[model samples]
Target: MLNEKKEMPLMVRQSLDQTYDVIRKKSIKKKRTFNPQVIIAIAASACLVVGLGLSNDHVMASINKWLGFDDKGVEQAVNNGMLQEDHHSVTDQGVKIAINDHFSDENKLGLSFQLAFDHPSMLKHVENVSLDYRLKNGDGQYIEEFIPDTKPLKGKNRYTSFFDYQNPLIDEKSGMVQFNTLSDSSEGTIPKLKDAVIEIESINIFDNTGKLKKINGHWNLSLSNNKKAEEMIQYKIQNVSSAIQVLKARSTPTALNIVLSLKGIDKERDEKLPSDMVIVDEAGHEYRIKGLRSVSKNNETIISANFPISSYNQHKKLELMIKGIEKIHLIKQ
Candidate 1:
């Protein structure tokens, strides 16, 4: 009888080994990793077999039922991370974006961007990202459009000229232009540039966290209230002709007397206009706009304003704008 007892214990031990083999085989076949939960389930199955101490075959059957062997296929035993499971919140993909042009004139724009994703790997596939931005008026007409991927966020990579006007250089000292080269092929025919409300959409496969992992999705963006670009060059007047005409016809016919009343300048006279900066009118006439005589206590620059100008009376639009200079204008009362 004592020998029978020893045999019974031996049978139980053999049965337990068979159960472990079954579980381990199923895990290997499914390519699944066993976590603490699976370990606990295995331990519980062992306890059930010992507590009953049934015949070896009967114990095996009981162990199978306890572990849900019939229902627990390899498919249900695997654990995948959140990203792999395809579950993420909307805010995860929505991130703040900013544009920057470290090498740009005060006028040209530099694009900047920032975004967050459900997974860090999303940042790796940024090559396919696309962004579109437009400035509009209240009527929904566009004022400007920007696409970073189609063209480099900046212009031609050329040095800025100081004295050169309209063509890109403000003066030999202060302004600059830049160009960038890209390897990506053009996606399709370029879109027309028009003034319209801002609209944005894009797709990307980024794995910012690592090269092997990637996040794939499309980005839809629309924004307004962008005040960054507008603040760069304040106080601008498009047509300075109405007043320039009267001054030219009455004054030295060739000279443009721009009575810049520095009084309107928001800053001090010394602070508004700077030394070495000359103000030129449309007549190709050049004169220093900022000097002891030019800046009055009332903050006015009465210096002679002469720049080569067109003689068309109908084109009465004399343009006077600050290029490399600090602050200046034609005084029209």
Candidate 2:
């Protein structure tokens, strides 16, 4: 019996030994010898059990599903092969904050995180939390022109946030020429920086009665730009016989930004312009506009329109579809 056990392969030896014991008991009751066919049958059954337990898809899918990564944004990133898994955590006052994943592009950055409290009852008191953060280069120069938006996911501890930054000018020379042609005062040029350091000042959370609770911790993070996943397109559209130059249309994993310049249109008329624009991707996914803000650059009226597109990385290209813009009359000063 010892020699037979030694002869068996290592992979199935333990399982075969247990099965052999059961067969030996049955053979002793029947007054028969330990049959070699019984040993072969038990070994084959052990191999089949091991093979099924080690299957890749079944194992990984079960693990991912157990980790609660079924959020739509997380699922999209995972399916598109763009998800970066980082499990960095910081704990303050019994509250643990973790940076689980992130995605970024030239125009926007998105962060997914989990907040676990030492006491589960504390989760019920968290009304809202705000992150105060900024981007800086290796030389520690700050990038000032950007906007951030935060939203909590369906889970009690999961949250996602995005920062919409200024897009790099298509033509640096053209931007300079337009800037100088429109303004008498001098302003600093916008610097193009990638893979910068993100400095987080503090996280403030409000309670049920509007009591402000501040979590003070300094967290520095560095992220690479997802240029391959981001798409920027330029288009010239004719509205009411006037040309509306879509200077840049940028799509990132978390947001879409469209820069529109209405040439020869009065500022007052541009102020009244509606930002009812929609984006359609190659996969037939539609995104609604979230915000529209006007920034003054010399005499050029640049309208920055932003849309929440959490699954933008899933598509290769997108189209800017606008309705009710052709009816607006542009006034020339």
Candidate 3:
């Protein structure tokens, strides 16, 4: 009876073992030493935070359920401090545009805004609305490879739009990020200026019958880069069969962007290159692929993919899983 009382329960023992394993691996990888007492305290705190005396598997399952790994994932991100809350507004020609919130990282900027029409009748005639926007730096220089993803929510009179813009030239600097056209993509040079002016030349509204109505005005706004908001992690691949390198990863409240470089590609067989990839966290939570783009620069191919993630602050390690890449022949032609 004394010996049995001294033994730890199976679930508790397993949880402690996993906790120790994670701490040991992180300490070794980070080259830091942790006192055993501190480790024990941290383990206890973790267990308490997750649930009183809950197994690791049960804790993760509860977390996954709370995160709602489905359509409500974005709501989970907003609750987890991944998205910024803003109340900026601008009005032009009786149309009010309110910037509600945004998520930004090194590679991309996502803006959520509400558009309210002054007249309810105007909403009926509008089948879609587009912003004609131009982003110029303090020196009037422009950033290159501006790609925009605009999504309009279902509504009348009051509508919401989420705009996602990708800028490879986004650095740790202040600049004006602006837009006003329906949608367009262009290439320009990276701006060196510290600030920028975003000018909206006009707002175009298309009716259900395809008639276009243009509202002409200069709607301008200024934005400064929040360098502290960005979080990036980089890892080097070891003992891999192919020359695939994950250059860096950026995590926002709403999404994760992984930058990769794949070497020795066959230009002739470009279609055979793998386009699908998955990011799995330590708890087996999978972040689905949002979008991907590949560009060739200086004889090297760089790939960038964005994945929507929920509860991103909970995980310490993520695995990048690429599919159907090994079968591709890499003979440069």
* Number of the predicted model whose lDDT against the real structure is largest: 3
Model 3: per-residue Cα lDDT over 259-307, one tens digit each: 6787755553333233346666667776554234456777677765545
Across residues 1-333, which tens digit of lDDT does each residue of candidate 1 receive?
000100000111122234233223432342222322100111111111122322222332232221221111111211110001111112213433322111111112112233333343433222122233333334444433333233332332211111100100011111111111111000111122122223333322212221222223333323232222211111234444332222221111112223343333333433433334354544655443211223235533343232212111112323354433333343322
Q: For candidate 2, lDDT tens digit of each residue in 220-315?
A: 656454345443332333343354566555444434446676555465565344434556655677655423445556666666654544433544
Candidate 1 overall Cα lDDT vs. reference?
0.24
Backbone clash total, candidate 3: 9
In angstroms, give how far residue 112 of model 3 lies from its true place.
2.5
Which 10 consecutive residues of model 1 have the lowest summed lDDT? 1-10
TM-score of each: 0.22, 0.48, 0.52
Q: Give candidate 3's whole-model lDDT.
A: 0.39
Model 2, residue 227: distance off in Å is 9.7
